[model samples]
Target: MAGNKQPVSVLVLLYTAQGRVLLIERADKPGFWQSVTGSKEGQEALLATAWRELGEETGFAAAQGVLHDWAQSSVYEIYPHWRHRYPEGVTHNTEHVFAFELSEESTPRLNAREHTAYVWLDWQEAAQRVFSPSNAVAIRELGRRLSPLS
Candidate 1:
């Protein structure tokens, strides 16, 4: 799938009721921690893309947890370093946000090809640790979601 990623993608944030967010360190770009993320396939539903990416990147099957589509999306300029993954002239992408809530933080079967390390941190700290702006935004939003009254 080299240089063929769709401009539309999914960002699945796996968290617990306690607000601990799961973050994975990218293998190709170590120290870049993020939630499960990937591009959509042709004509695929955004929900399906989220589920697929969840399993592929973190080994969490759809049946293992319930996915919540926050119905949130953000369009941003793609990072120059990874822009080659998309077609020529494609400089931006729309990322749809989804979330999977677990009762507790569980060990995920991390895909070594994509990630080298994993950590579960409080939403605030996770938000600060993510490298991508959009990813950080999503994580920060997680706090609001878990505590809409706070």
Candidate 2:
């Protein structure tokens, strides 16, 4: 029997206090860059999914810095090519957003199977560089959070 499809996932925006965001090029898809993302395994909490994905994908653990749940979500259709990962008839996924703010830029150990390389860029460039719409939305939201309130 196929496992239950997890509708919840996490999209973690890793950034520096200076407002630089980290983006990784996907190994499976050349030129496609994105932040850390993954679905919850079993019954893990949403935040746990974020932390686990961050550590798994980038070697950055949220325990060392500020990890804020933006309390935002986006539901979108799962791409046709990658739909096999989910159970049958699972066509959509809801991604919860989180941000990990570091004091300075740090080296990230990329999982070669998942990513080719990683780069840190200013929020604007990062937003434009990411391929996924939900990731771009998270980056824009991060910009808003970091902006001054006047």
Candidate 3:
């Protein structure tokens, strides 16, 4: 119906040269962890959405990090609990993946109503720690790209 969200979203994973990935705890879901993610507002471009969400969710400065577009996308079913945020009959979401390379691990000012805490862990650990399968896969993919063996 009207006043519902589009099913397009962005997932921005922040990582460092040391392969540490940042994971944030959701304020609403306590233990549920994820990278910075949010839906595209109206007709916003994907890059704009990425930057908007990064700043909105983590208080990260737009000019502070190197942002990379993984040129990857995933379509997954929206969790039942969050379906209400989208329009009627919208069961799936198309998430574009990106990564921000930080020079080093840094603390983020979490949005109190969106996220409560943050942790920086090894890429593998972060992949396993995130609540969404797609997010996990993206982190693992980042690991593979950053790994010497890959």
Model 2: residues >4 Å from true position, as ranges?
Answer: 1-5
The 10-residue segment of model 3 with minimum total lDDT is: 1-10
All candidates: TM-score: 0.96, 0.93, 0.96
Residue pairs with clashing backbones, model 3: none
Please state the error at residue 24 of candidate 2 in Å: 0.8
Candidate 3 error regions (>4 Å):
1-3
lDDT per residue for candidate 3 within 59-104, as digits (tens), equals 8876778999988999999998888888888899999999999999
Please, what are the lDDT tens digits per residue for candidate 1 over residues 57-132?
Answer: 8888766778999999999999988998998889999999999998879999998999999999999999999999
Decide which is better by lDDT, 1 or 3: 3
Q: Candidate 2, which ten residues in sequence have the lowest lDDT sum?
A: 1-10
Error of 1 at 141 (Å): 0.9
Please tell me which predicted candidate would have the highest lDDT against the true structure.
3
Ranking of predictions according to TM-score: 3, 1, 2
Candidate 3 accuracy as lDDT: 0.93
Q: Model 1: which residue pairs collide? A: none
Per-residue lDDT of 1-150 in model 2, one digit per residue for the tens? 334668679999999877899999999999999999999999889999998999999888756688989898999998888887788888899999999998888889899999999999999899999989999988987888788781
| lDDT at residue 113 of model 3 (Cα atoms) | 94
Q: Would you list the rank order by lDDT, best first?
A: 3, 1, 2
